[model samples]
Target: MPRTDAGVELAGVSVRYGSAKQPVTVLDSVDLRVGAGEFVVLVGPSGCGKTTLLRVIAGFARPDSGSALVGGAAPRPGRGAGVVFQQPRLFPWRTVGGNLGFALARHGVPRSQRPGRIAELLERVGLPGMAGRRTWELSGGQQQRVALARALAAEPGLLLMDEPFSALDALTRERLQEEVRSLAGRLGTTVVFVTHSVEEAVLLGSRVLVMAAGPGRVVEDLPVPLPRDPGTGVPELRASPEFARLRGHLTEALRPA
Candidate 1:
């Protein structure tokens, strides 16, 4: 089992939209905690405030109430939290190397150390070379890998990802999922990921949290038994009786009696 010692915690968090004229509650008193080196997945129907919760953790949006803490401290915006979204959001004009180099430069890395650090990150994410290639030239999966490498370059204490693999094809998505899981373990970073797929949640999450639709709250929080190793073969796990048991449990929890 993976260590659950480090991670981000959310307490009584809620997000509301509209004034007295029209109030829309997106999240309601949701509380969640992701352990260190653990990968936790958020899964629900569309418009379930999944992305909103991720944003709150990333410090991109403030919750209407409660607090989001990274490693027990109030989250500091754009500081130690690294985020990767559905879109790669790379700079079209900059080469792959440039994109990473820019991130390293922002952290005030000296020029002498930039090359080695950039190469290290690239290798870490399985990108290897192709540093000088244009971002647009890479496939969707490759681009996302670069984006992830860029995120890791910051040496963030926590990583927040919002439906990052949802945009790719099945094979690419599965491959990236395996790669991301491995990278997170090796890097020892806590990851709070949001997705709509139950299989994905089971495959990648150390713990899976199911959210209710209207006012998104954690309706179910269950730990996944499957190991994170790629050789574990998530598809086979899905076909197992245990997988069916847990999947049905999550489905029932999400729907209620």
Candidate 2:
């Protein structure tokens, strides 16, 4: 039974596209449940349908069979789940504040409070006083930070991210990963993040689910076996023995089965 306390749940969930006669299954019989405040990372090789699983939970894709639910029921689009894509996806015409304000407004935040909320969100994402900056003026990493802030501005119970930091440079990617991990912990935000990097998964996830290819199904779901170092701790985390072990296991799991 899916737990009532689970923030996100999927039971025997599968998805397919195209005509029925020649249907292609992207996700296959995936069973998962994430409790509130848990950061769950989904990692797999290319074409493993990692992003598709996220889409299902984000209410953007219907499963061909079984169920996907957020907060104990089917998620409603733009409601229970906040989604962040591979690209920043911020409107070029909108200022950083405008982008976040749009999400807050859509979520019924008062117009009078939007400015303070936008500032708070920008500060949360490490972009203090940056609301006036246009999207184009920010770096790739900065734009992605804005995207993250916009998603959080909705105050969704769950956040679904599809490789949001993949396009960034290695250093920037590391910075944002730590930022997200710490911020999620601070805000008690439940996150489902997709990534190809084993180190990233180990570093960010409370539990990491490794999926298989073809009709994607989870091959391994392992709890990250390290104490979270909340302050300036990722470097120490990456150097730890548990990190090495999990990274090795995940790397092996991603190989052809």
Candidate models: Cα lDDT each: 0.83, 0.87
Error of 2 at 253 (Å): 1.3
lDDT string for model 1 (109-218, tens) is 89899889888888988888878899989999999999998888778868889889888999999889888887777767788888878778877788999888888889
TM-scores of the models, in the given order?
A: 0.92, 0.96
Report the lDDT of model 2 for residue 95.
93
Relative to the true structure, candidate 1 reaches a TM of: 0.92
Overlapping backbone residue pairs in candidate 2 total: 0
Off by over 4 Å in 2: 1-6
**Cα-based lDDT at residue 18, candidate 1:** 85
CA shift of 213, model 1, Å: 1.5
Number of backbone collisions per candidate = 2, 0
RMSD of each: 2.6, 2.7
Worst 10 residues of 1 by lDDT: 1-10
